[model samples]
Target: MEEYKIRIVKTIQYIDSHIDADLSLEKVSEVSAYSPFHFHRIFKLVTGETLQSYIIRKKIEKSALHLAVHKNMEIKDIYWDLGFSNHSVFCKTFKKYYGLAPTEFRRSAPEKFHKILQIQSKNGQVDTVFSQYICNIENLLNWTKMNLKIEVKEMPEMNLASVMSLGIANVEPSFNLLIDWAKKKSLFPRENVKMISVYHDSCKITPLDKVRIHACMLLDERLSKQEGEVFPETIDGGKYIVGSGEVTLDDFEQCWVSMFLWMNENNYSTRRTFPYEIYHTNFKEHPEGKMIVDFCIPVH
Candidate 1:
C-alpha cells in the first residue's frame, strides 16, 4: 500500500512537470513503474478520476494559475501555452469543463484575475474569484417563472435502431459508432439522434448504473436494417409534454436540474414510456456550448 501511494505521487509529479507535453497512459504507466493494463483501474481506484479526465482537469488548474499570474496575456496565447492545438479546441474543452468561456470567467472576477491587484497594495491582499454555485430547485423555479409556455404536440410512434453502452454521456468512441452507422445509411437527414434515459433511480444523486441511456433514432418505412443486425425495434412511444430552453455552457447544470424540478412540480413524470432528449442543434458550432434541446416527459 505504501509503495502504491508512492507510485501515485510519482505519477502526479510527472504529470505536473509534463503539462505541456503529450502524456499518454502508456508513458505514464512506464514512468510510474506500473503495468499499462492495470494503470487506469488502479489510478481510478486511488484518485477517483481517469487519466484523460485528470490530465484535462490539471491543465485547467494550471491555466487558472497562469490566468491569475499573468492577466495581460492574450487568451489565444494562454490556449497554446496550455498545450491545446488551437484556440477553438481549447475553448470547447474549457467550456465543457468549466461551464464558462475564459473571457466570461475572467470578466466575472476581474479583481482576482488582475495580475497586479495584490502586488500594488501596501499590505498583502487577497482577491476572490466570482464563482457560481448551482441551486437545483431555486434556479428551476426562476426559469419556469419566465412563463415558458407548455407546448403540447403529438409525436407519431416510430421504430428505431439503437446501440446501448455504459457511461453517462457521449464521448469519442461511442460517437464514432453513432456517426459511422448514420453516415453509411444516411440516417442523419431523415432520422435524428434521440438520447434516452430510463432512470430506475435518481441520476442526480445515485450511482451510474441507476441510469440507462440508449442512443436512438426515429425511423420511417424508408429505414432498413444492415446484415447480421436484428429487426429494428419500435421505441415504445406515448404522449409527452415537451419543454425546451437554450443554455450556455455556464448555465447547463443549473438549467438542467431546474428543468427536471419543474417537470416534477408540474405533474410531468416519467412513465417508463416516452422519455427522451431530442438534440436539435449542433454543439460544436455554438459559442460557449449553447444548445437548444427538448426534454420529453410523460405525464399522468
Candidate 2:
C-alpha cells in the first residue's frame, strides 16, 4: 500500500511539472510504471480522484492562480498557456467550476473571489455564499467581532500518525479511528496529545467528495505496525500564519477563507506545504460546544 502511495505521488508530481503537456492516461500510467487499467484504479484509490479529473482541476487551478497574480495578462492568453484549447471553452469550464466567468472573477475583490469559489454550484449556477461575512475584509472583521487575530510564527518539525479521509465532512470518523488506536497503544498522556488535520487539496477547486483530509496526532517517532488505516509521516517545519478561534463545524470553511484573504491582503504568498488545523480543545465535549482550533497555513 505504501509503495502504491509513493507511485501515485510521483505521478502527481509529474503531472504538475508537465501540466501543459499531454497528460493522457497512457502517458501518465507509463510514468508510474503501472498498466493503464490498474493505474487508473489505483490512482483514484490513493488520491480520491480519477486521473482525468485531477488533470483538469490542476489546469484550472493553475489558470486561476495566473489570473489572480498576473493582473495584466489577458484571460485568453492565460487559459491557452495552461493548455485550454480556446477562450470560449476556458470561460465555460471556468464558470462551471468557479461559478463565475473569468472576467467577473478577475474584477472581484480577493475576498469576494474566494467566497464565490467556496459556494457549491447547483445546476450550473452558484446558489449561495459560504458565509455572508466572507465578502470583504471589513465584513470579516465585523463578523469576528474584531477578534480574528493572525500571527506569523516559526514552527518546529513534527512526526505524526495520520489517517486519510476523502471528504471534508468525513474527517471526524478518521480522527476517531486514529484516537482509538492511540489509546490502545498507550502512546501518550491524554492531556499532552496534539490533534491536527492536514488539508491536501483546495475545497474551492476540488470536488467535495475528492478532497484529501489527513487526521493526525503529533508523535515523537513512528509507531510500530498496528492495525487499521493510520500511517506515519513527517511534516517539515516552517513559518506559518496561525489563526486561533472558537468555531463550529459550519465555521471551518470560512475560517480558512478569512485567513487566505488576510494573506492576500497582506501580500504574503503561501508555501507549498499543506495547510492544517490544530485542535487545542476536546472538540467533542467543549464547554462552548465549539472547537478551539488553530488554523495554520505555511507562508513566506
Please tell me which predicted candidate would have the highest lDDT against the true structure: 2
Q: How displaced is residue 274 in candidate 1, in Å?
A: 4.9
10 residues in a row with least lDDT, candidate 1: 125-134
Clashing pairs in 1: none
Pairs in clash, predicted candidate 2: none
TM-scores of all candidate predictions against the true structure? 0.44, 0.54
What does candidate 2's lDDT look like per residue over 81-102, in tens digits? 7888888889888888889988
In model 1, state the lDDT of residue 17: 72
Measure candidate 1: CA RMSD.
Answer: 16.1
C-alpha RMSD by candidate, in order: 16.1, 15.6
TM-score of candidate 1 on Cα atoms, chains taken together? 0.44
Off by more than 4 A, model 2: 1-137, 224-227
**Candidate 1 residue-wise lDDT, 1-300, digit = tens:** 134445656676688678878799899989867556346545554455678888988787667656656679888888787788887887788778768877776655555554532333222222121011112223334565562334546656656665554556542344456556766777665534553333223343345643545555555663466433323546445666776776554554444444444444454555567456666665677876766766665655
